[model samples]
Target: MTGVSLGFIPEPLLVALDHILPSRRLPSTVFDSRKFRQIKASIEEIGLIEPLSVTAMDQATGNYVLLDGHVRLLVMQNLGLVDAVCLVATDDESYTYNNRLNRLSTIQEHIMICRAVDRGISPERLAKALAIDITSILKKLSLLKGICTEAAELLGDRQFSSDLSRVLRKMKPTRQVECVELMVAANNVTVAYAEALLVATPVARLVEGKKPARLAGISPEQMARMESEMGNLQAQYRLVEQTYGQDVLNLVLAKGYLAKLLENESVTRHLQQHYPDLLTEFGVVVETVSLDRRHFAETT
Candidate 1:
């Protein structure tokens, strides 16, 4: 068996800030951004949590090229830091360092906070370290308190508010999963959409089997109508989902056939003379990219 190759040195090296050269220049506006301010505050409060990633030192100048953590580097410079720890990469390719990066999702943040708290970190300390309010940290800590495992897993990578989870908590586990699936499918995972789903939910599907409170302008009749319509919409969506793969396959085959047919001069002339509209439509199907055609099929 072959050993797996490592990108960075196992041990981090302490390097002077002056000797670390940034691979790319950041925009001037970035210095004034909220993200920059948060990082600066976090470092000021607790110190840098993640070390910078840098390429191996150049023998000529004894300088290391920074592969990642530009914001942290700038923050350290602003804070008058002289020396910092950096992981030295085996190669100078910054693209691999950045391209593989994953932003923290809401659930991932929750898990991190929970882990830190379990390690005896207080909410106040966490808030200061994250440069957010203590309430926000507490909210993240309890983000999945009432969420079912299936729904939470479905929304694991999604960034949504605690209020959305609260809304989900009002429904039974099955309803929660359904609502989450609907919201994710529509790409509208906002609290508003979640609330709309909650409103349309049948009373039996609610957590306590209680009816949802009516909105100011919506009466019982209106809510009932919405419930029926939403159920129909969900059914239609699932039906489409079931057939989407086969539909795309059929369209691909049809497009390929039409493309080859259009290549023949005789067939093209026959369509152009007697059925110009049909020829134009055929040309569209033959020329349209798969993604655009898929979108058209879904919309129609």
Candidate 2:
């Protein structure tokens, strides 16, 4: 059968079962047919009142290929349904269309924004189009090129705080949860402070052998109750970049100094006067000098 072009789908259409999947190029992974069978059973039982999305492809091997509705097409195949009606398109067009600009959740939005930026979408243009903070636009877009989707989701959650972005950026994905735990448990802490250590060290030095101490006054038994909260994301989560977190990296760096300066009484006092409740604001302190006097003199 000869294929033709269909545009701006006012309605969803179907393509033949065989032609729907990527024939010569099956994705390395795909939605399992067993899952589709369940969907098919439900849809078939109810009648496919909602049309499945598809793009008809004309290829040398066969007549058509399905772009987006692999599951429905597979289900239909199992049900011995063929000759499905579909809007036609080429393989390349669907590639962009399937993954193109669209609304997403904060996390999903991050993924999309990242993809757009990677494709050379300007930060200024993206921010203007999205009606969001350019910094935020860049941060969301940074997820694709900077942090793993797993860690990005963690940062995007409002409760998680922008500080985690520093941690996620500086620490290796393998070390992220450990860093997060250290972040929460440390007496003096902030996203920025934790981020500095993450950038500087692989893991914070937690006391070995679990003796004579507790985190945040929580007993060991109580701490164990929320074990999952401190757990790493599922392994399927891909964190590709070394420079994963950058949005609030400045705070992270500033806190590094703050944490250091607080170690001395004189410096802490200076910080308190200049920064105002510096300890609470920074979760640490700052010193007037570049470094500790003893260390500075020794280095010089």
Most accurate candidate by TM-score: 1
lDDT of 2 by residue, 1-300 (tens): 897654445554554565555433434343454455456655554444334444554556665545555555555666777756555543345552345324334555566666767788677766655444578765555543435555444434323433346446545554555454454434333566564443333123222223222234655554554333343322212231233346236545775766766678997688677876646756522342234444546633
Error of 2 at 229 (Å): 24
Query: Relative to the unseen true structure, what is the C-alpha lDDT of residue 39 in candidate 2, on a scale of 0 to 100?
Result: 64
Model 2 spans with C-alpha error above 4 angstroms: 1-34, 49-62, 90-97, 100-300
Worst 10 residues of 1 by lDDT: 94-103
Write candidate 1's Cα lDDT for 147-265 as tens digits.
Answer: 89999999988888878988999999988998999998888889999998988988888987776555556777987998999899889988998998999798889998998999999
Clashing pairs for model 1 are none
TM-score to true structure, per model = 0.81, 0.27
Give the range of the ten consecutive residues with the poorest summed lDDT in model 2.
205-214
